[model samples]
Target: MVLPRNRDYFQIFLASLSPMIFVVLLLAELGLEWVYSLSIITLCYLASFIFWFKNGTKPAAWISKGKLHIRDGVFGTDVIYKDRLESMRYEIGHKRAVAGSNAEEAEMHILVIKMKGFDEWTLPIKDLIEHGPNLRLYKFIRDNFYNLKLVKK
Candidate 1:
């Protein structure tokens, strides 16, 4: 059983940064007309959005050999085995989180996995939205861990 990584977050991250990126480009060019710069930026943003929409999300993960291998868009390839799997939980939004967090940074259904003798981890669900719906992922985690097959790769 190989699970694949979702790359929807790549587009979301790019979209969020596009405005600042455009402003930087516009300002870097000396004496450029604001209107012209804005136009260029707008076009770039549209093009980038279109490109991502057309080819959004990557399926590059596997859960075979008793290990979960994922190609994270923000990080990189991450591999964790069954033995390391401890437990799983959900992240509370900033407002509801006991520790508190920025509302914008908090998203629902952020999967948190705990490992034996290790820190907890988050599986970004917002990034997976573009690839497809992720309701099934929760179920999968529940069913797998419920069986307590945490041992060895």
Candidate 2:
């Protein structure tokens, strides 16, 4: 089964703006002229499109042949085999806050997978839990993995 990328384009575009805004503000504070600041911001915005927006387009995850594949970036994918897994965990907490909201935050559901000889891999499954077609992924993990740990807050 494949879990396609669930991130929205608008969200990615907004996320890219944060750094651009900061750079422009810093340039202004440094007494740069309006033309120079505009040029710099334009460059930064274009870079964000190339790096951030492009990177967000990929499959979120997929399962095949007793292995789980997680796509993390433009050039990176983490593969977890069922046989090598040491422990599996599901955790919920305030690890990330909602964008542009100071007092309101969303609960992040993270799937923490620990393999025998590798560092633990944590994938935020908030989108999966809320927007997935079904709970097949959750059920598959629960049924296949042993020593499953669930932590809720």
Candidate 3:
């Protein structure tokens, strides 16, 4: 089974912009021309788009037989055989809103598969509207790994 990346555009934009706006303002305060500061911010955003958009073309994860494959980067891929998997967990990472705000931002739900004698693999959940679209894929992963762990006990 192959899984989607499940990226949200609004989150990415906010993440990339929030820090950028602050830095640009700081630069403007530190004697840099406003035009140059704005240009710098624009360049940074362009770089981010180049990096993220290009990588969105690849598969985020796949499972074949008992092997789990995860894409790390353009040339880095990690593979873990089912038999070597130790334990697993799912977690939601959140971004606490500013002190004055009454909101929290959720980044992505991550499924962590721990394999024996190797580093754990963290893969994002694909259960989003345009991604996995349901819990079917999530259940598929949980059931498979849970059953394996159960049998080991």
Top of the candidates by TM-score:
2
Index of the highest-lDDT prediction: 2
Question: Tens-digit lDDT track for model 2 on 51-101?
Answer: 877777666667789887766444567677888888888665535778899
Candidate 3's C-alpha runs over 4 A off are 54-60, 64-66, 70-79, 83-137, 142-153
TM-score of each: 0.41, 0.56, 0.47
TM-score attained by model 1: 0.41
Model 3 clash pairs are none
Task: List clash counts for every candidate, in order.
Answer: 7, 0, 0
Off by over 4 Å in 2: 64-66, 71-78, 86-153
- Which should have the higher TM-score, number 1 or number 3? 3
lDDT of 3 by residue, 25-121 (tens): 6777887777887788788878766665656555556788888666654445667678877877655442334456677544445567777887888
* Residue 146 displacement (Å), model 2: 11
Every candidate's lDDT: 0.53, 0.69, 0.59
Q: Please, what are the lDDT tens digits per residue for candidate 1 over residues 82-142?
A: 7777886644341223236444342434656788998887665444442225444444544
